[model samples]
Target: MANVYLKEAIRTMETSSGTAANYEYASTSCQGWRNTQEDVHLILPNFDSDTSLFAVFDGHNGIEVAAYVAKYLPEYIRQNRKYKRGRVSEGLKEAFCLLDGQLLLVDAVNELRAIRRQAHPELPEYKPGITSGCTAVVCLLKKDTFYCASIGDTRCVLCRNGKAFPLSIDNKPDDANECARIMKAGGEVVHGRINKLINVSRAFGDHMFKMVPNMSTIEQMIIPLPDVIIEPYIESTDSFMVLMCDGIWNSMDNSEVIDFVGSRIQKKMPLAKITEEVIKNVLPKEMPPSGIKGKDNMTICVIKFKGKRGGVGSTNMSAMPRTTVRGNNGPNKHH
Candidate 1:
């Protein structure tokens, strides 16, 4: 039997705003066959009781970035001007981008590198922080609008009616467009890979692999955090949505998740139970062993909406259809 460790957060039907969360979040960790490479968090903002949601912060280069984001991002949103009481989407955009920028200030990285050098003067090849990279996918759903952003290979997907929409894109070096841009900037996408190691084209805290002072990080490049996908709501939409990391997707596609969830929904299964099934069923296919290196963690979150009405008898999936969005890794990418 496959073992799955899961953590999740679901917005209450009636939030402090006296409104429904209509939004939910989940984070999970699976050491699995591979060592634990994933760290995730679902954070709720204090400002908007009506906000009905939080975000998933997935970390790679250790849990530092993810931990950093989980600690400060929500607080940042609460103080930002754009994050007016109910402006969930706008607030999310500002918070996510702002957090991405904050990584450069991780002064400890250089210090850690210094310590490593001192410990192994002869083995100069040991670079402590360079090979570290992470992906992040953030989603915020308030009332009728859904906001999303992502970086790296992690993803965010939405399901409305029976159709599926991908809210986030994979930012890999092999991607022709990303490759072209990297090359144009005097940077090479070596080995048919963006950074010659990981596939993600943009990320946070991969100090060594970053393009340097001239190229700048996603924050400095003025690259918006992953684009936001917003959809309205009508009557025909499902009442629940799922958010998960790549571990789940490695085995299950949108249709598969939808089918499983749909059947469970008909059976009136609890949201938590449904999410557990996903983790139980979908673990990575070829993970490494105890001492071997591979992906770190797996996180999942599921949101279930209630009583969505679009005036009179409207069935617009675009308007709304219980959507499932997922985010993974650490920093929000600009792909």
Candidate 2:
């Protein structure tokens, strides 16, 4: 039997905004039974201009990559000139790409080595060929608008009118476009794994899969390009948003998670407690057939929008506009 390594402790963080929208947010991370916690999250309520930014980074092979992204991605977004000019979509895209490039720098590797030495002196020094990466799902809310950027399998779902609307697409080898891109870059997808090793087709800091020559960053085998989605927040219909890693998705479908969260919100439960409950419901007590139970680190973030009257669905319903931004692909406009 595989020894069960349980990090049953759960960590929670929360903040509230005094802005006109009265947005409140809560987040939690549970190491689960994994030997190491490889998940990291960010919560920046009232980031700027009454905006909030929340994200979850799920790391594989090591936690350094996820921790690095959580520390620097937000700074990159804030520093992007496009973001200051109100071109948030472009800003996010640029930020994702810029961070990926920074990861390949020699200084970045030295920093990682320093961090590892400080944290674990016994571990061998970080090397150039080291393999590590992370999946990122970020949600940015400004006024009545919501923007999301995702890479890899981490997901974001918006709960609207008691229904779950996926705000991000999962990047996997099974995806036709992703698979084609990989094959064109001299990479192969075998058993749903990219190059028979990495499960995600897109991610940040996987230098090993990104060694293809003469290929643009976006055309690399496992690129850092994120699919960006933008939506107008409908005060009346839209309830809340949830960001989580694949650990939560592996056990529950989108609708199941929505229903569970909706029931908890209806009971007036705290957002942090709601996440804790969701983790409890999904994490298995023992190793399952898939061997995924308790082996993956779980992280969740919840953002609650408080309307003028009070809770969600308290206002009138009206048609809202939506827009989605794709890399290389043309813009998808909706009403």
Candidate 3:
């Protein structure tokens, strides 16, 4: 079985929110019915003088990979040469791969051991290998634009004038481009899963799938490349943006989610409350639709731009489903 549930669900919610230059945000996560909480996120409202960063990570096998990424990705992005050279797009793309490369078990031994010793000196530090991985959805508010980079199905959506405009696309194994890459790497998409082991075509870590002879990093069965989407931050129409994991998307589509969050904001509900209600609204009381993955770990990040209209009141941007390539889903997940 790919999923596990606790005897009883954990209803407690972890929430965070803050304000930056022209941006304000709130994020929340729930352990739900899962045996353990594997989702993680980061909220840096004042990342720098002119920019801010927000992201969500959906851990697959465990939380180690997601937690590590949540802790290190910002520093990695900040240090990338391309980003330093003013090529933000290239910088983000390279940063994802660079970070993933550091996860190679053979090379991470010293690093992981050192980190583990410091975090939990009494706990065991030995592990066979790095088998865990996570889906990443990152959003960087740079000046007057939004840069969203993502791998796997985690997503970032912008609510502009009450409309849903997805910033990052879902990278499922069933997707054409994703499927093609998997096949070319001698991997198969079994029941929409990569080699019947994972559902996402791209992710951070998951080193088990990266093994193959004579293949470049991008040619691996599971790559770390991220799709970066750029959208201008228009104050008049763009209200707010939503960055969420599959847990949230599993139950709500772009329209329903945008409208759901918007209606709450219109009622003047707090951002943290809006996020908590979203998880509560979709949390199942019994076996989830498919028996495979029942209730999931839920996470959401909302970024607001104080504007003339303010997302349905926060993020109403311009882009249709096709134009933005929001994406497709399959069983073991949602469609």
Each model's TM-score, in the order given? 0.70, 0.87, 0.86
lDDT of 2 at 311: 30
lDDT of 1 by residue, 186-233 (tens): 566676555455556656556555544555344231232454555554
Q: Please, what are the lDDT tens digits per residue for candidate 3 over residues 1-335?
A: 53367767888888988776576788889988887687989888767667788899988756667778888889989998889888787778778888888776465645654644564454454441256788898888876668888899998999977799888978889988888878988899989998888999889878778778777777777888887887777676778899888888888887888999999999999888898888888777775656534388888888777763223234444442222312221111100
Order of candidate numbers by lDDT, starting with the best: 2, 3, 1
Clashes of each: 17, 1, 17
How high is the lDDT of residue 49 in model 2?
60
- For residue 126, model 3's alpha carbon misses the true position, in angstroms, by 8.9
Instruction: Please provide, for model 2 over 123-143, each residue's C-alpha lDDT reduced to its tens digit, 9 standing for 90 to 100.
Output: 444452148789999998776
Instruction: For candidate 2, give the lDDT of residue 252.
Output: 85
- Deviation in Å, model 3, residue 283 alpha carbon: 1.2
